[model samples]
Target: MIDALPPLREVIETHGLSAKKSLGQNFILDLNLTSRIARIPGDLSGADVLEVGPGPGGLTRGLLAEGARRVVAIEKDPRCLPALAEIAAHYPGRLEVHEGDALEFDPRLLNGPVHIVANLPYNVGTELLVRWLTPKVWPPFWSGLTLMFQREVADRITAQPGGKAYGRLAVLAQWKAEARVALTLPPEAFTPPPKVHSAVVHLTPRPEPQFPADPKMMNRVVAMAFGQRRKMLRASMKAMTPGIEDVLVEAGIKPTERAEQVPIEGFAALSRALTARGL
Candidate 1:
């Protein structure tokens, strides 16, 4: 984890950076740990990396030291600009820090096939993932995603059918990508430790989806089905459009089946069938 730079604690002190509860910031002051996280994406030497919320540039430094070709980092907090500038100067054009909210920024601005690696802000983690995953295009802007989230959310993202954790997130994540929990960290790892443990999730875009279906309808169908997860599909999806039972039958899913019991393929099939019916 040792590089030619000063330690993260010194950098934080020098920059006068402190964790902000409103922004969901928990600065990880350990460069050794940050370096380990940076390597999670594996050989970013040829990759254009995009990092969200690079507070004090701890992980940004790690990414550069770990051989990322270039990093386009988006950070909303203006206070960390000075510290990030120092890291950029040290790396000499290897890093570019943008002052903006990642929630509204355009990933298309970065180079093709970007790799998103981050210790995400807790408050907006799932919202960002939904935006990235539900893009209009078949293949997304990013080629790969290695992100940190609460352990509970990680379980939900990688969950499968017929499990307590399985639901809308599980469907959307696994439908078009391969996702898994790569690493787990204790609460004490952060500057001001969060209440729950954190986990690192690695996701790679699939060359093809689980099945062919209209993207908008696929998401809508899945949302409606899981909207009342405890109820049978025939009842839960009734309000989305008419002929709910027929749609399930066309998809080869039983009308009596609940949302949690249906696989991703089933949802895709349902969406395709619904689109065909022009409903």
Candidate 2:
């Protein structure tokens, strides 16, 4: 067991802190859980880590305690800085807490090899993952993402075809990264416990997507197709294509296929066709 960091409950009480709903805070004080998450992305030693919404720094402490070479924590809510600062002091420079919004901050701008680990603020978790997956450049800025999301969202992120959860998120995430469910934490594990149970998902970016497609067009195609997921591709993509059957033919997808039935490559092909037609 790691022993460097103090008990997270003590840290929270000392800061007179409670999770703030406005900030989408759900502080996980369970060292066991946090440590388990910290370990999900493999060896942390000598790796730079980007942590977001580190309210009360439980996961931050776990990352550092488990020997991450450096941690840059971006906490959106200013109220949590003092609590995080205490952990920074405890670790003596291994931790760097940035009091700002992680969404606006570009992880690519950070110095070196980075892995992202966060018990993410629920409101922005899916958006954040999309941003990372479809960054302006391919082969994203982070080495891996070990993040906590509502169990349902986690299911969608790592879901397979033929499942209700499979749709745009599964296509996008799996197209660019290898994703899997790492662990699940009950509601009671957090300070101001969230109504939903949380699951940790680990995603490693793939060197190449299953198929080549323009990122912007890919996003648009997925958005449009899944925008009316129940409809067949021929109907759903009709707005952009009077000849979606032909487009599907050109891409080797079937006109009758639904968005959930098509895998990542199918979306990539559609994305490429739309880009080719300048849709």
Clash pairs detected, candidate 2: none
User: How well is each residue in 1-279 modelled by candidate 2, as lDDT tens digits?
Assistant: 356656777777877777788788888878877887898998978689999988888788788888998899998877788878878888887888888888898676566688999989999999999889887677777889999999999999999987799988998899899999999888998878788898999999999887798877888888988899999989998987787789887888999989888888788887888778867
TM of each candidate vs. truth: 0.97, 0.94
Put down candidate 1 lDDT per residue, 1-279, tens digits, no spaces.
467777878887887888899999988878888889999888899989999999988889888989999999999999899989988888997899899999888776788658999999999999999888988786888889999999999999999899989999999999989999999999999988999999999999897787898888988998988889999999999986778898789889999999999999999999998888887
Error of 2 at 219 (Å): 1.5
lDDT, residue 74, model 2: 93
lDDT of each: 0.90, 0.86
* Residue runs of model 2 more than 4 Å from their true location after superposition: none
Q: What is the lDDT of residue 68 in candidate 1?
A: 93
Residue pairs with colliding backbones in model 1 are: none
